[model samples]
Target: MQLGLSNKDQKKVLTAFYSLGEVCGTIWDNIV
Candidate 1:
């Protein structure tokens, strides 16, 4: 299934997810 986002948009989404994952990781590390 595709969301029909353009290449640039896809890149933005990927970057957003990457940063979000990093943020979550930092929070998890702090909690533990």
Candidate 2:
């Protein structure tokens, strides 16, 4: 199940994921 991403790519992916999560949370908070 490994996508074989290099360390740099993995970091970028994680950063993007966290950024997306933060954006979603902001929207949710505004809605609530």
- All models: lDDT? 0.95, 0.94
Candidate 1 residue spans exceeding 4 A from truth? none
Q: Write the per-residue lDDT of candidate 1 for residues 1-32, one digit (tens) a residue.
A: 46999999999999999999999999999999
- Model 2, range 1-32, lDDT digits (tens) per residue? 35799989988999999999999999999999
**Against the hidden reference, what TM-scores do the models get?**
0.91, 0.89
TM-score, candidate 1, is: 0.91
| Strongest candidate by lDDT | 1
